[model samples]
Target: MTTNGECRTNGTRRPKPLLSRSCSENYEINDVDVPGTPKTPRTSTTPGHEKCTFHHDLELDHNPPTREAMLPEMSRSYRLLLESLGENPDRPGLLKTPERAAKAMLFFTKGYDQSLEEVLNDAIFDEDHDEMVVVKDIEMFSMCEHHLVPFYGKVSIGYLPCGKILGLSKLARIVEIYSRRLQVQERLTKQIAVAVTKAVQPAGVAVVVEGVHMCMVMRGVQKINSKTVTSTMLGVFRDDPKTREEFLNLVHSK
Candidate 1:
């Protein structure tokens, strides 16, 4: 019988212990001398700039939270909710309902995972122009903390710059960040005005919100067409009646 390191009558050496028959029988194998095509170049590993093969920034970006990581816990909680509602969670029609509901709920309340710092970063700018900057009709949607129902509407913001100004879109984003959370309309208006004041320290900040609460429309008083108006004024806006009046007129105008 042929043994290790032995040659056969056909002029082929016995296969090495680590190699398969596909390896050339006549060539000596060296562990250190691997032979094949060259390796492809590795991707750059710069921080916050890595190349993602799938789901770009879906896993890496954690400012608002990732849906996949929250899915499991949220789905289990939703199933319990179904039981509380006396609904069969295992039925064919409801089997996947928990997952869908979890995803939807997470999306609706994602503001809980975000912070003002992350949203405002790189969005504020210093400028010398000191005029009243107004962003009107900024749409917002929020859940009423009292009833967990939706309240949605538009906001009007006006600010007199002291030495800084926010990006126009950033103002809208600020509204979205706070509006996505469980909130009351009055507090939501004040929070938007406060956020702008804090970010830019403008001479004055004013915010007005007109919302229709689902709790009012869907239940309780069931006032389907009723609207709630709330406002917050700071600095010169609160001190100067003329400034406040102008802001109100601009917001109420078509």
Candidate 2:
């Protein structure tokens, strides 16, 4: 006798037994012997026979928030700090100050997010010109690392090319990168010089900064007109008096 779900093999009907249990719920099924077809036997349960199913196609979704999404919240906290400092955040003049300040700060401190390599990408060119190249009077605004007060300044850079010269704008960019962070003027000047020297492997590098620190003028000494000058001289600039004098004279000339 053939079962309803059984099929014939070699044009002969095969004997198969019908069971009340289904494959989904059954612990086991009996093998049915049939003519011209071999029977498939089921093994008895061993110690660790556990039912398992194979599945295909698994996926994951991941998303991260952007800087723009988080900046507004940070600006709000800064605005609250301003309000706590006894300033009215709702005043007509101050209404947009917080947002503006946040944006300006983002611009000022953008150097932190930029790499020196990326900033000077392809900006360096091979040049046999060994003369001093000076770019002067680049404006800089930074916060004092000590007091977080504003310090505005001018920077002048000069370098003697060994076999490479950087783009004029890149020198200013180097200054901006160091200046945008909270820094001591001395360290900022040295960092700029060191970066330029390393980037171009120049024969010499000199950096000079003249700054008016708000902390000094607004609170400490209160000397409004006093400006601090700091500089770094490397390689030939340190050993050669004529080279150093040329750099200094050009920087202070105007």
* Top candidate when judged by TM-score against the true structure: 1
Report clashes for each candidate as comma-separated counts.
Answer: 0, 0
* TM-scores for every candidate against the unseen true structure: 0.72, 0.68
lDDT of 1 by residue, 1-254 (tens): 15553223345442221122222321222211111111222233545436433221222332323568768988999899999999999999999999998888767766655556677777888775666799999998899999988999999999877546789988998898778777888878877876776677665778999999999999999999999999877766776789889989888889
Q: Compare the candidates by lDDT and give the number of the best one.
A: 1
User: In candidate 1, how many clashes are counted?
Assistant: 0
Model 1, runs deviating above 4 Å? 1-67
Q: Spell out the clash pairs found in candidate 1.
A: none
Looking at model 2, the pairs that clash are none
Candidate 2 regions exceeding 4 Å error are 1-66, 87-95
Give the per-residue lDDT of model 2 (tens digit) for 1-254.
23563324445542221122232231122221111111332222323322311101011021223335556876898789888999988889888887887777767666555556767888989764667899999999998889878899899999877556899889888787778876888878777876786577665678889999999999988999999999877766776789899999998895
